[model samples]
Target: MDIRRLKEEIITYSQEIGIDKIGFTTADPFITLKGRLLRQRELNYQSGFEEPDIEKRTDPSLLFDEPASIISIALAYPSKMKTHVRGTKTDRRGIFSRSSWGDDYHIVLRNRLEKLEKFIVERYPDARCKSMVDTGELSDRAVAERAGIGWSGKNCSIITPEFGSYVYLGEMITNIPFEPDTPIEDQCGTCNKCLEACPTGALVQGGQINAKICISYLTQTKDFLPETYRSVIGNRLYGCDTCQMVCPYNKGMDFHFHPEFEPDPELAKPRLKPLLSISNKEFKNTFGKTAGAWRGKKPIQRNAILALGHFKDETAVGELEKVLKHDPRPVIRGTAAWALGKIGGKRVKEILSEALADERDPDVLEELEGALEKLNHETKA
Candidate 1:
């Protein structure tokens, strides 16, 4: 088979299938990524994937014994229509980053990659292919860069000139020995804006991130958020995008027009009152298909309470008080207490006094005391 002809055909096919960029790379990104992962492990930065089997991540040989090439593709999500900012008065409008404003990217990218694989199989009947999005052990950003699609920026995201960092990545691992593209030079010269813009200081020097301090990880984390990072998390209920938002490359990009990514009208900017009151059943029905729905209602509800706390919305105090005692998740209960404290006047103090009588969790008890202290100071004033 003529490799050049195949490369051109692959790129053409990818564009026809709605993929914005495609490039090929030999199955290795560990030259840069391995050190970063090791540092992250050493710093105790990994949130969900603690004890990440570094051998699996660093060695492409482990992913596929015969791995010869990787086809990296980028699909741009809409950016022009500021759906989050549109038609909403509440801060919850700003909760989710624009990347997550639509359907889950994993599903979108996986489906497209499967179709590409079918096309390749028909042409090369003897060849084998496997596709992975963010799920697998492959270093997608490194693959994309090596494939000449775009360079990785200081925020550690692949930055394409057309799609910016708003593009979702998908990869096709194949045994076919395709010609590899040259890795692009880093384009983030002297710009520390992404590092500066990080609310929780998750971004370190040289594009490394500590997941423990990352709002994206914190929102997705199953355990309680660290105390130091709580105040910095702000109103972001899902992933945080301050780094991308502050990047200059993302400017003037057209909004992604895929209907699959369109924001749900009800969820685009949910009212804080309704969000705080949503039942688990209602939460499932409302956001089951959306990206933020994966973690269920508790984290989002907890985040809503945090947003309310930031806004100091007195109206939320009553609801906050009620949830503080009865919410199944201690994280939710703890955040609710914090919100009540921020909005506290008379009712909040009464509720805290009531909670103190039965609250047993050390963390929740500490939060309760902080709430009471704030109320005591307010009352003395």
Candidate 2:
């Protein structure tokens, strides 16, 4: 079998099947990434969501015997939604970052990889292939960087020349000696836009991100968000795109290559008030297909409440009062008190005092007291 022609065939088929970009690289250990990850762990900068096993992440040989090459594929997602949905002052909306705008890319990319795997298995009966998406042990960005899919950008995204940083990446490790594609030259020379634009300063420098503070990771966290980050989180319900939006390469880059990736404007930027009371069944049915829903509606609802406060939506006051007074989750109730404090009014002060007196949970009571004090101080001034 001619390996050169085989690679070309795979490329052609990938294009036909809706893969935006494909590249191959030798399956050598990612030595540099391991060192960086170790530094991240040492500094307590890691998000804790990543695969904890460092050895499994950097070495493909451990995942599969005699791995020859890694094939990386990228699918560009739309940056700008065609059908815009704006929110009214009374009904403010929160955004699910562009990455979560459509059906989960994990499923979409996995399907494409499975197709690629099938194609290879048919061609070479003995070929051994293992594919991974974002949840996998190996870093998708690292594989894509080595496979020439794109350069690992300053914001820690795989920035393809054709698609910028708004691309979903996946990879397949195989025991096929496919000639490796040349890695892209780092073109982000002297660009400080992403670093400057990061709300939490999560991008420590260049390609290194302290994920612990990244809005994307923070939004997914189940626990109460730190007070410092709450003010900076803005109206983002899931993920954060400030870094990519500020990228020069991402300018005018929007690809609607796959129908599954098309955004439902309502889901992408849903009304914040309606989300606050979204039932479990309703939330599942409406947002189940989107990537943002993976963390369930708790985080989204909490963010929505914060967004209401951020916008100072007086209309959300009653709903927030209900959440503060009666919600089953202590964290949600506590967050409601905080949001009410931000949307300060004499009514909000009264509401916080009432909730504080009635609250039994020590944590919720502490949040309520802080909110009441915040309001009381403002009232006196």
- Give the TM-scores of the predictions, in the order they appear: 0.93, 0.99
lDDT of 2 at 170: 95
lDDT of 2: 0.93
Shift of residue 31 alpha carbon in model 2, Å: 0.7
Q: Tell me the whole-model lDDT of each prediction, alpha carbons only.
A: 0.78, 0.93
Q: Which ten residues in a row are the worst by lDDT in model 2?
A: 371-380
Candidate 2 versus the native: TM-score? 0.99
User: Runs in model 1 with CA error above 4 Å?
Assistant: 80-94
Off by over 4 Å in 2: none
Instruction: Tell me how far the alpha carbon of residue 373 in candidate 1 is from the true structure, in angstroms, after superposition.
Output: 1.3
Q: List the residue pairs that clash in candidate 2.
A: none
Instruction: Give the Å shift of residue 369 in candidate 1.
Output: 1.7
